[model samples]
Target: MSQPTIRALILDDYAHNAFREAHIERPQPQAHEVLVRVVASGVNPIDYKIRSGNAPYAMPELPAILGTDMAGVIEAVGADIKHLAVGDEVYGMVGGVRGLPGSLAEYLAVDADLVARKPKNLGFREAAAIPLVFLTAWEGLVDRAHVQAGQKVLVHGGAGGVGHMAVQIARALGAEVFATVSPGKRSIVEGYGATAIDYRDEPVAQYVNQHTGGKGFDVIYDTVGGQSLDDSFAAIRLYGHVASCAAFGTHNLATGSLRSATLSGIFVLLPMLTGVGRKHHAEILGYATRLIEEGKVKPLMHPQRFSLGEARQAHDAVEQGTGIGKVVIDIA
Candidate 1:
């Protein structure tokens, strides 16, 4: 049999521009891998940052494919893979960087450890929107902070991709969730079962005192880092836990230290970048599927659709901050 050719969105170099209709070599599954026919791909800010040469960690080899999250059906399973069989619907953050093939292609040969059964309640596009953001939120809130019921939790940037997911996850976990957003997004943030605080008009200290009676939040999750991370240090109560996925700045930890609060930083790309702890990511996806099926967790997807050929536009949408929710590329 002749090798098959696949249509993929390939990123040739680090620039704001990307090209579509690139023919790439299709890959067969390794013994522990499964071949997936990609149905949808999710776009993130990191995708565009890497495209523009802003993120050093996303250094894909030249002429690479650009994507991170995807949902699809299994076409074939490798000999050693036991959990999945052909025709199983699945989703995961497969690749697009670090020498691995991404989900922008019509097909992907990914390790079984990097994927999970898609939620029975979600379509391919919705499922594609969950893996990366949900996994990042889960690891920070559940795995790192160990958030418990009745605890007062505050999430920065509650209207963003990771922030929205974090708010929902914390609410589902029984925390008294509070989220910071702009005035225009109050209802959107509150709809996720969190009290919305307008970060623009309200000072962090004021909100902290108002909500927690000056005790401060028991848990603070920072999705928007830098200045927000520093504010989290001051807003957390004594012995409180703070988790941040985007902590990028040089700042004094004096506030947190004075309050005796603990801080943890989450970097969700480690597994895909170094190939370590890959199974844990799959396990989290499995949990997310269960949550979605139970109607406890739901992804907020943008209404617009983009074909694989319009990948550049999809990247631009995320970069321009025009997407209300996750920006997805439909690959039929």
Candidate 2:
């Protein structure tokens, strides 16, 4: 085979305004990593935050490539990597933070344990969108809440990125799922096999009374956070569990305390940022792969697709909420 040159978009600085394309030497895999030919990269809100230099916790050195999730085909495997080999298609949240190189390139030297075989049922675009959101949802619903059959589960922002995944995961786990959404998004939540509560048209107490018959949900997931998290406290049953991926503000704990409820905060980037729990992310995605192959989970793709060079536009779509679901870049 001829020598390979990596084509990547590099951001020189926060004020650079755009990613400039450049061809550099291809990277070789390390002891525990694999060389992947990137086919697609998922555009997320954090991508824009880091691109604009807001997410310091999730960005690397200057002129970095900033993509969190990618799906690609393996070109070569490191000597120590045994589970994956050349020609294998895979996906994962590889990097873009903590001095680790990101995935907005023609290739990635991905940690082997951070990646799983891409579900045979999903294309590169759909698979590329699965990592961060899916891991967040899985950590909240399954790991923290211990969601089980016959439980009453409520997912806030049910039509959103993590919200939609939580809804489907709850359904697949045999929980009776209810989702809070705006009137316009009721159909979207309901389409995922959950009952949709119009947060605007109904008050928290009213929905809690009507849906749970004044009892409350066994588990409540707050993907929206802020006031939604307060509502979650009121909506949860005595000794129930609540999980929030967007927990950032100070709030009164009396509501949860009075009910003896427990709240779990989810920050999925801990693994990537610290490198301590990286394998769990890969394991969660492995489960998602099965859920996807079984037709129990699906990606809600954005209407507009992007090219490798239009990453800025893709980031805008995600940040502005102009896209229907996920905005993905076609890298290959």
Worst 10 residues of 2 by lDDT: 54-63
Regions of model 1 farther than 4 Å from truth: none
lDDT of 1 at 301: 83
Q: What TM-score does candidate 1 reach?
A: 0.98
Strongest candidate by lDDT: 2
lDDT of 2 by residue, 102-168 (tens): 8899998988988999999999999999898999999999999999999999999999989999999
True-structure lDDT of candidate 2? 0.91
- lDDT by residue (220-312, candidate 1, tens digit) is 999999889999999999999999998877879999999999899998988999989999999999889988999988888899999987888
Which ranges of candidate 2 are over 4 A from the true structure? 1-3
